[model samples]
Target: MLLGYFSLFASGFIAATLLPASSEVLLLALAQQGYKPLWLWLAATCGNTLGSCVNWYLGKELLRFQHKRWFPISQAQLAKAEIQFNRYGSWSLLLAWLPIVGDPLTLVAGTLRVRFGLFLLLVTLGKGARYALLLFLARQLW
Candidate 1:
């Protein structure tokens, strides 16, 4: 039981970050191993959101310290992301599930000082919907 929870958390965290982890793989593995789907979904969602929040916090800190020189990110890129984030607002987080761009979007949201409450709400909705869709597809295909 504990192992299952740990796996879900790890999967969620890695999925939210720039790493190439797959939460669906872990989810399906756990489900095939007899874990409860509802609990797994909740755990995965909470862990993913927390991981995304970590990225947001890092973005805030980066802006605070002006650490662009040390990081690979350039000011021009950040500026473009900022403009898009500003135009889209928290709804931009809807793309939080997209590959490659999702992680950066979270950071941009924080850098833009998007409302924390709205950020959480949008991230939850986007991430939750993503996992739910994956679950449905898994059921249909597997």
Candidate 2:
């Protein structure tokens, strides 16, 4: 019932974060169990988008702590990330649904001070399309 959808949403949210998770698998499992595909898609998309927003916020905040001994990344590494992100520009947010590099891209967007509205729009489009395609494939296969 609602719990299933909430679980999917939570999974999506966690998956989009730096934390390791896979909302896609949960989504497909729910689809197999006969939950409405459209609702699943919506839940997953919103959750994941919100999660990326959190990453963006963290990216903005991290700059303040880059010189701290507890900061996780080295200055060079941060600069490299900034360079890569700048090379790609804000359009890279459109790939926020990707596996390895996706989460970091969202983070970089915030560090670069990308507009929140644009970040949300691109992230939503990328994440929603991914979930939609997964659901479509689930329907076709099962």
Candidate 3:
């Protein structure tokens, strides 16, 4: 049981980050093993959200560091991200479900000092909807 929970949490965390992991696999495995779907969904969502928060913190720190020499990111990229961030604000987080750009979008939100409550709300909604959709598809396909 503990292993199952850890698997759920770890998969969730990795999924929220830039890493390429599939929490769906974990969910399917757990479900096949007879775990509760509701619990699995909640655990994965919460854990993934927390992991994304870590990325947000890293983005905040990256903005503060501003050491172009040490960091590989170019100033132009940062500036562009800032411009988009300024224009879109937290709403950009809706794209948090997209591939590649999704993880960085969360980081940009923190770098721009977006409101935490709004960030959480949008991230949760986007991520939750994504997982829910995935679950639905899995149910349909399986």
Candidate topping TM-score: 2
For candidate 3, the lDDT comes to 0.80
lDDT of 3 at 130: 75
Q: Best by lDDT, which number? A: 2
lDDT of 3 by residue, 82-136 (tens): 9988787678887686778888898888888877788888888888887777766
Full candidate order by TM-score, most accurate first: 2, 1, 3
lDDT of 1 by residue, 1-142 (tens): 9789788988898889767776878887887787776787788888888888988887777776666467767789888878877787778897787888899889877878877888889998998888787766766776
Candidate with better TM-score, 1 vs 3: 1
lDDT (tens digit, per residue) of candidate 2 on 1-142:
9999999999999999999888998999999999999999999999999999999999888899877899889978878988998898888888999999999899889888899999999999999999999999999998
Number of colliding residue pairs in model 3: 0
What is the lDDT of every predicted structure here? Answer: 0.81, 0.93, 0.80
TM-score of each: 0.88, 0.95, 0.87
Worst 10 residues of 1 by lDDT: 64-73
Off by over 4 Å in 2: none
* Worst 10 contiguous positions by lDDT, candidate 3: 63-72
